[model samples]
Target: MSPELNAPGISEEDKARLTQSGIELSMQNRCGSYLQMNQDVLHAECQEEGIEVLSYRKAMEKYDWLKEYEWKAVPKDKDEITQYVASQTDPKGYVIIAHKGTKNILPIQACLYLGRETIQHVHNIIIAEEGAELHIISGCTSGGHVGQGAAHYGVSEFYIKKNAKISFTMIHTWTENIEVFPRSASIVEENGVFLSNYVCMQPVKKIQMYPTATLKGENSVARFSSIIIASPSSYLDIGSRAILEGKGASAELVTRAITKGGTIISRGQIIGKTAGTKGHLECKGLILKDGTIYAIPEIDGRVVGTELSHEAAVGKLAQEEIEYLMSRGLSEDEATATIIRGFLDVKIAGLPEALQKQIDATIDVAEKAGF
Candidate 1:
């Protein structure tokens, strides 16, 4: 790891926790990295030639055109969380931009670590110019020693220009005492592709987020996938929406959720407003213990030749399936764990192999702990 990226007051245990959240301190296989400790920007650097990673304030100072993209996708007056972030006198976050026609196979890593018992807020903007391909992995976690009343409020906006592609994968590892609220949205231009994947397998006090994507250009594509597990004392309400406004645009939203003595509310929505547009929404949830799993899926088609569909299912593991797995000479616990692992697996089509492995490893750790 670069010395500048290594912020002080980070213990070995904290490093391990961040690693579980897919924050690589070593910076290997990362084209760029941004680390923010509390409300301070520890480091932000871009190793690739065409990619620019800078602090939010510095980026604003450098590029006057950035003002056009700021708050355009996510409205500042949308909710209290947005209002709080907009009220910050000293803004804290990172701005990453991929120049036109540039491509980086290795993703950029962004880490947000909260170490104190206070509110941590950030406003992030990510832009991919025409024909540019950008990938990002964001890890958000709280320090192990953090006390109660710690909260995180974040606002993010994504802009994918014509023929550009942006794949964003986020993993969260907040503790039982932390509450997180993230408000985010995206806009896709002509022939643009946007893929968003979220994973949260740890315990959290409360978390609520509903990200939206608008396909305003012809043949644009968007996909959102999420895998989450809620433990005891955890309340997670997550949702994703995609609006197809251009001809030939398409979108898909998929989610896999599991709850063990906790509450999980999974919601998905898709709206098709133009002819030749297609969309689908799916949510499948499993209840491991005495918990609550609510799935709400909606799809709307406004014009003729637009197709939309949705399917939602919430149920416990069938005993017949568990017995079948145990009949293969495995123990009962092993059988149950295997079934749960398979249930939570939802492969994203365009995600990189490294990020897919990271997501799988996180679920493996939880599976080893008996879900």
Candidate 2:
């Protein structure tokens, strides 16, 4: 084990227990292996059977862009934002640092698995040089066994160089006592493209996040898709935003959220500030029992040829839709489950079939969890 796997705030024995229990409980039957993080440390990392991200130091050496944006993801304007920056320690979270023009798929998992009261802060970085392409599947979960409650605060930043393409899929399955806050952003240079998919169909005590992407070069593109399910007593506030700051840049933000006996605020926005820029925002919500469901979608444009649009809707499964599914032989419970599941599915283009199918199944299970 390297020094990165030594969790600073946790004892060595607890680290071993957390690492083993976390991986075993949350990482079964997913990818071959994982870059695991127990709380704020690099608990363990190993190459899966087929996919790999080269060592962090090797990736830093091979990519010139890493130097330009290292540790520059968090903005310093807000105290709340800068507070997370202050919590960082070396090797705070697993990293996916790829060599220039490299192509690979990475599967990663990071969590605080200890059941005792604990606070975990993490920072994850991804760098892709010009013409490089990568696919990533990342899952974050908390094991609420002995440490009944834990707080996970993380920041992620991605640097996508010219012509580079990155597809990111993030899944969150946390316990009711776990509160999550992930602040993430991406910088896409000219002609670069970034596509992200987020799905959280599990029950969590509370979650609040609003990640953004900035298209800073001409012809750059930013796209986001998210699906969330909120159960009884669960409070989720999730948002996705895109900023088009270069001529000819484009962006899209799409989100779907489901609430059953909980409060869910679904938000998305697109801001186009340069000439010839275009963007759109969309949010759709399904309320099963509902404490509250709010969908807020906004779009703003400035300068010539800059166009923006948005649409938002929040509602429950219509009786007719549930009855129609029942006509096809599903029981009442199954019919409601099927409807909720389909409502939360928002397909992302260019996603691998295997991962997409897996995400689809995860959504179905999450959406019906409270039903």
Candidate 2 C-alpha lDDT tens digits along 1-371: 12233334445554443432223334443332234444423333444432344333444556676556656765643447447655455435545644567665534443434345676666667776788776676666655452455787777788888888888777776778888888888999999989888877767888889888989988999889988778897999999888999788988888887777888888888888988998988888877774788888888766768999888888877999889888999998888877776677678777766457657767555544543
Clashing pairs in 2: 115-146, 115-147, 116-147
Off by over 4 Å in 2: 1-34, 40-67, 87-91, 105-115, 146-149, 367-371
lDDT values of the candidates? 0.92, 0.69
Clashes of 1: 0
Give the C-alpha miss distance for residue 4 in model 2, angstroms: 19
Each prediction's TM-score versus the true structure = 0.98, 0.83
Q: Which 10-residue span in candidate 2 carries the lowest summed lDDT?
A: 16-25
Cα RMSDs, all models: 1.2, 5.0
RMSD of 1: 1.2
